[model samples]
Target chain A: MLTKRIIPCLDIKNGRTVKGVNFVDLRDAGDPVELAAIYAAEGADELVFLDITATVEKRKTLIELVKRVAAEINIPFTVGGGISSIADVSALLNAGADKISINSSAVMRPELVSELAGEFGSQCVVVAIDSRFVEGEHIVHVSGGRIATERRTLLWAKEVEERGAGEILLTSMDHDGTKAGFANELTAKVSGSVSIPVIASGGAGNQEHFLDSFTIGLADAALAASIFHFKEVSIPDLKNYLKGYNIPVRIEK
Target chain B: MSVVIVDYNAGNVQSVTYALERLGVSPVLSADPEVIRSADRVIFPGVGEASTAMRFLKERKLDEVIKDLKQPVFGVCLGLQLMCAHSEENNTDCLGIFDVQVKKFEPTLKVPQMGWNNLEHTTGPLFKGIEADSYVYYVHSYYAETSEYTIATTDYVNTFSAALNKDNFYALQAHPEKSGKVGERILQNFLDIK
Candidate 1:
């Protein structure tokens, strides 16, 4: 049976894990390698490390941080943010990262997704889409959910899938940081539209919210930040809650 | 000593490298004939269109080098397809190491067969201790038609060769690296085979 994944996303900046509200106003979380090991031990199926800084100085540091984390952690990790070319994807994958997530760069050059998928296997490629509800329509946003694209979320998701994205990480900008719950409706819509696995991101405050994302949204995985980072909800506790709810999860020995 | 993973422009080499590392072996990714011949073992993993992959191998003259390798060799997914005499995918010619042809699975059974499927009829050192009917990960539309080379079989819509073995040459239609513990065990078994 396929296990539903529980992932804790960490934003790395200046070689440290940081968290922010709405992708701004960052505060220190912890060392990425330490946080990653904690999550893996707690039964997280995987981890995603996004380099939040856009400047050149921090980019080099972030790549080095990715190398360190990849070296230490045994579980699958995905590195994203500012990934522009096949070389970037290769660098992360070579560093022991299991997958690479592309956002702004992917939207700008959709062909890169296909090219990377061709070179590496599709399972190594993940496309992260930041979407916000604009006038009752889900519009795609890039550059950390700041710039809105003309493309609709669902349409772009279909395009990415056809381009050979192994999985879709759909983050609802509208619900991000709200802690109200996941955008179940949007996740369900995208999951239904794409043949590949869809991972629901944003708006998780509690264990029940995770369940809602799995049951209502039909998401294959649920990713969150502060809730897991702040220890407001431990991954084992959350998995226990989900197991009580009968959601399939891999229990660690 | 580093294991050599042939880079013939096929996919899944990264996963194989990671899997080997998990089993405490570091592999060197290479396409050069000398590098491959000098390594402890050679892994020929593949993904993507069979015809295009074969063309890449032929262009690099890796086709002949791979056929003459004296060390143990392993193939996965499209790698298995290419080892066969022919493939239904793009009607391409292959290495013909094993007298078998890769055929496309029935369209009605979901073209890709993308998920966990059970392995049956297991018989090989590669599957040594792996329980029968254990699920291994798979993703592809074409499969190797049953032949004397086949050592294991699986069923999606119908039974087909899940694994093939002939002397030092071994190929798996499913990805053992991505298949979790069962996959890791299979890989360990492959490494243990002397």
Candidate 2:
């Protein structure tokens, strides 16, 4: 009977919140701390802060930002991007993040997922997969969707779950920034294949898309950026809409 | 006054500290018996294998110290599991504060019942203004069956105790620290209790 979560992902660059189209043309959303507090108050089930510049900068702003956001909001927040080592995961957790998300690093070194999960528990480690449709198959994308690996989405997700990843954040690069709807087919494939919680991301335009992602995608949570950042769809409005559709949601007091 | 959180290789201590700080309560992380006993309240949070964690606790004599504490104590996730008489996890004996055994979830349902779950049957001051059937986040495979100490119940594949209370000892299977406002309100209720 766990409530279906409504999450808003904030892509951070240079300590500022930014959202872009297809991971480019970045625009300033606002201060991460401010935006995180707003989302928490507005009934967001959780928050995801991805330091988009972590690899290029060779440093992570997520830990400090997580510390600041954790000081303000009383909800679960996940920090991801440029998490390459156990030290990085430890730092983010110490900074107050409830979960640490790893993308390219985890893909490159699959053992890192199990190692961290073994040390910190699987519940704290989230394996984020950026997948793109290629030649009629979902191929795993790395380096922030710049490079496509030979592995298929379902194959890698299964491996990560076997290696002890507690949750999977599946974002479809083709659907990202499209504002159409989630990759329901791909999500359902992964959700049906893995027992871990699957958070569906990318291509969420309206409330119907959210509903589709849950009912059809079979996702435990639906995560979006543009719709939430631009105020095209508020968390409460979305939650009310989902409730009307028989999806269990936690209404704000 | 700062609450002391015992860090004996358990999980979620940092999140608990973070949640307390967000509530305007500063909490200090410590494993020293003196620090824990001196604090206004003590929080015991854990994750990972129960037997291994119990080994860490027993080695530090924390098991004895934690049992002898007079201040209010709160256990989260595996911390709650370890406070029981025994756990199916690694077949380890626990602190016996709750006199119950923690059993693994039925294999029929998915292992590690992750994500947000609703607390259906609830009571005690910890629930306070929180409505029955409120949702809280959970991630675990083992669960404590209903017992005399159970204060809240949640349903997944089946109904199980989500929260337990006995005297000054309180434990929650779900991560209240990560459960958002309902969780924050529960934390505030615990802080307000005499």
Candidate 3:
């Protein structure tokens, strides 16, 4: 049985973790490597390091960070944010990142999805779609969700899958940071529509919200940032809760 | 112990090398026939399309070297698929180290079947201290069917070979490097094989 995955997403900037992590034992909360190791030990099925660093040497810093994290953390991690070319993805994968997520680049040139899948295989490509429900229709947003695009969320999701994306990371701008719950209705529609695995991101406030993402949203995996970083919900406890619900989460032995 | 990961333009070799490092063993990545053949343990790691990987392996003559290795040669993911007799992917012929056929999963569920899945009927040195419910990470569209070489099985779209062992060769369909503590222990056990 393939168990539902629980992922901890960390925002990386300048080769360091951007968001303030609240892990007590962490020596340097800014150190993404140490933070990644902690999360891996605590039963994080996977990790996503979204690099928000923008500079001339951004690629160098990200590759170095990826090498360090890969050497320390045993679980698979995905590196995303500003990854626009095959050269960038090649360097990161060579540095030992298991998967790479692409956003605006895919929207700007959708051919990139097919090219990446053809060159590196679809298993390594993850297409992240930031979406918001606008005027009774879900619209795709780019540039960290600050700008809206005419591409419909569901249409883009299907297109990426057809273009050979291995997975879809769908984040809802409406529910993010609300701590209310996930956009289950929208997530469900995408998950049901796409054949590839869908990872529901954003709006994860509580353990139940995580459960809802799986049960109601039909997400294969659920990703959260602040909840796991702030110790609001422990992974083991959440897995246990999901297991009690017969959700088939991975149990540590 | 000289552990060398056979790199034939396949992905995930770095992760496998780092996984060995975590167990206090530093592994060298090499496509050189001498380095791979002379190593005490040769780790064959791969992640990519079958035919493309096969082409590269043949180009470097690593396929012949791998097929002739007497030392413990462990294959991961696509490496495992390439060890078989034939792959439905690209209709390519493999090294025939393991007498099995690699077939694509029916779209009853997800095509790639990505996520963590537990191993069952694990019965080899690679699974020495691994518990029954130990979950390992996997990402692939195709799987090798269970055969006499199968040492372990996992269920997703169907029951497939999670791990395979035949004489000096051992292989795993899942990414042990990314499977956390249980996976680390499995890698350690493979290194401990004598």
Q: Where is model 3 more than 4 Å wrong at Cα?
A: none
Tens digits of lDDT, candidate 1, B66-110: 888877888888888999999988899999889998898775543
Per-residue alpha-carbon lDDT of model 2 for A178-245, expressed as tens digits?
98999999999999998888999999999999999999999989999878877889899999999999
lDDT of 3 by residue, A78-134 (tens): 999999999988888989998999999999999999999988889999999999989
Please give the distance, in angstroms, between residue B64's alpha carbon in candidate 1 and its true position after superposition.
3.5
Question: What digit string (tens of lDDT, one per residue) describes model 3 on residues B11-128?
Answer: 7688998889989998988899998989999998888888989999999888899999999988999989999999999899999999899999999998898999999999978999
- TM-score for all models, in order of appearance: 0.80, 0.94, 0.98
Residue pairs clashing in model 3 are: none
Single out the weakest 10-residue window by summed lDDT for candidate 2 chain B. B107-116
The 10-residue segment with the lowest total lDDT in model 1 chain A: A20-29
Model 3 lDDT vs. the true structure? Answer: 0.92
TM-score (0 to 1) of chain B for each candidate: 0.97, 0.97, 0.98
The per-prediction CA RMSD against the true structure, in angstroms, equals 4.7, 3.0, 1.1
Counting clashing residue pairs in each candidate, in order, gives 0, 3, 0
For DockQ, the strongest prediction is 3
